[model samples]
Target: MLKLFFRHKWGPALLILLLAALVFFYNLGDISLWDPDEPRGAVIAHEMLQRGDWIHLSYNGHPVTDNPALVKPPLYYWSIALFSALQGHVDEFSARLPSALAGITTAILVFFLGARIFGTKTGFLGGLIFISNHMLFEQARSAEIDMTLTFLITAALFLFYHCYHEHYRPGWLYPAYAALGLAVLAKGPVGVIVPLMIAFLYLLARRDLKAIGKIKLPAGLLIILAVASPWFILEGRAFGAEFFFRQNFERFFHAFDHIQPWYYYFVKLPIHFLPWTLLLPAAVAYWFRRRKEKNPGRTFLLIWFIATFVFFSLSQSKRSLYIVPLYPALSLLVAEALERISSEQNLASLLPWIRGGAAFFALLLVTAGGTAAWLAATRFHDLARPVALLVAAALAGAALLYRMIRKGEGRGIVTAFLVCAFGLELLMAGVVYPSIDVKSRSS
Candidate 1:
């Protein structure tokens, strides 16, 4: 039993269990809606439940006046509203459950895609890193559109890769296109724009423009139009010209509400990626070193990462979560780098460097855990000290798991699985649940 549980194929199943446990733990307390965004998103879904007015989104018994009509699609809210209908009230669990599920699904898809593109070890490592990411973990517990957009956009990229490289079936591209369309509904044009930019640049770089001709663009367009048209049509009918001008066009060219300089994402990327950002230089170095290789998968992933970065960097408005879709591509590249480090005889000398990087990350995790404990003790002194201690212990445990990876003494499969599960369980049971309780009471 122990042997079978440690097998490579078991990694994904373990990841699923870890995600489920996290979601369950995060929602154990009385449902709490945090401030502006989460509660606003929840209330919109709640309104959808009460009024049955899916087309016109409202908040606190008033029509939503802030953004353009259909600027943010109704798909996420609709999912939450549907779940709320089943439960009778839109609680934190019901509100953020879809994002949590999507986050897990994204990890699973990354595993499959990585394994298909590289190898099982690479896939496992990539998936582990993805699930362990702080941004993804935080997003999973929040009622935000970014997580949903990440899932859809990643799924679209997966489909696009398969359809372009392996399947070559016209039918397969529909899902890719539909996923993009749904992504647009989830966020906006950035969803469709990012993928298209990546695909185009990838083909261009590979001089595979001829392959683009094989894509049956008419069918893809029809599929996209079908999936994306309903909301636009509804919003147009409901809000008239304002929907088209403000939501459709203005947000892109001009900043409507929260606008920042174009360089905002450049500065934000490092902080958003956190410890993982440290590895990006290594990943990019490996990418350039292998650019001459005729591997389609590597080329595709490289283009995906570059195109996503360029696309977001050029945009007038910027948010950290906007780059979530690029994570899979970046992770795949990092996995490729790690694989080269593990396999190349000459590169074996870099093992110390790899271990050193892991140690650095572990130190960061420990520091963060200590800081969290300090904050909890100082601010929430009313709460039991054991809670903060437990949270700290969990974070330390995650760091220790990374330490084991640095030692390179255990089975890669087992280490990866345990690390992922431990990280997920720790976040869900320790940080997430307690944070929810703290935020709830404070609110």
Candidate 2:
């Protein structure tokens, strides 16, 4: 039994899932729903349930049908309402449970997508990277629409890749379109916009505008309209078509709120990517080296990243969660690159890249742990132990990973980095989270 558990094809995926569950679900409801978004989302659903009118939602007894501003779409609240109804309450656990479940399912889907397209190793790494990511950890545990929206977007992309790119199965596009339709319901227009951007640009990059002709457009549209139109019809009459405009167009150009500079996402992306962000250089180097190849999979991932980045950059209303849709693409790109580092045999080809990754990861962990130390020593003096211990772990990880890299042990270096990521999480759980709780309560 133990051997099967360890040696199964999905062994790594299952293990990473366990870790992800621990990270995302262990104390999901222990912390109160964060004000504004979390609580607001919860109330919208709970109120809808009480009124037995799922189509229209209200908050604090006022209509929240405006979209992208005072109100959000009903899909997320509907989901929360269903989960809360099942669990017999609208408390924290039931409210946040759906997002956490979606997060886990998304991670699993990442594994499946990677394994199908790249290899099992890439799948395992991709799943691990997706779950261990800085933003996924936070978003998964929170009762917010962004994570659920991310799941739908990612599912659509994966289905598209499977049906259009790999298998030539037209049936897959139906589900893919359905996923996009659901994504549109989950958020607003951005859901459909993201898929269109990725699918169109990827085909355009291949210089085949007619490639879209192969998709089941009529059937796909039917699926989309069937799944998505009902809510819009109801909500449009309840609110107005202007709500849709505000959710989509206004957010793009006007920046009524969530205003940030054009470069805001550029600065914030790497931080959300966290530990794996250290591997971006290696990923880029691989992309350059393989640029001559005609690999459609790699081309698709690159297009996914580039198109999403450019699209979000154009939007005047920017928030860190806006990039959640892009994380799966980032995961696949980094996983494919990391798999190369693990498997490549050419020292000269691999040395410079590995050296950069190793050095960056070591320095990153040390700097993060050191920053925690400084904060705990001075500003956060009461939370010194976890931060200081994290510093020690970071130093230890640096020494070990650097040594492994020098020895040409690519896998060992990755393992050491994973260890350090866990160390950081531990410190956050021990020191940072408690500090936040106390501060929240006092305030």
Best by lDDT: 2
- Enumerate residue pairs that collide in model 2: none
The clash number for model 1 is 0
Q: Looking at model 1, which ten-residue stretch has the lowest summed lDDT?
A: 409-418
Off by over 4 Å in 1: 1-25, 28-31, 65-71, 237-244, 369-380, 383-443
| Candidate 1 lDDT for residue 115 | 80
What is the RMSD of candidate 1? 3.6
Residue-wise C-alpha lDDT for candidate 2, range 1-443, written one tens digit per residue: 74455345578677767877777777677677877788888888888888899887788777776443555667888889998899777988888888888899899888888787787778777888888778888888888889999899888888888877664788788888898888878877788888878988887888978877888777777887789888788766645465667666877989788889999988899888888887788777787877797878878888888888889999998989888888887898888887786777752476567667778888777787778788887786666665667778788888888888788766777767677666566556555676677678876
lDDT (Cα, tens digit) per residue for candidate 1, span 1-443:
64354356666547654754464345432446667677777888998888988987887777665444323677899989987889889887788878877888888888878888887777777876676666766676678889889899889888877887785776778888989889877876667878887878877887889888888777777888788888777766645455545665676678565577878877877676655565555556566666777888887887887788877666666678878888887777777776686677766555555555555666666676677677767786654454465556657655675756656732342354346445545655565566557766877
lDDT of each: 0.71, 0.79
Q: Which 10 successive residues of model 2 have the least lDDT summed?
A: 1-10
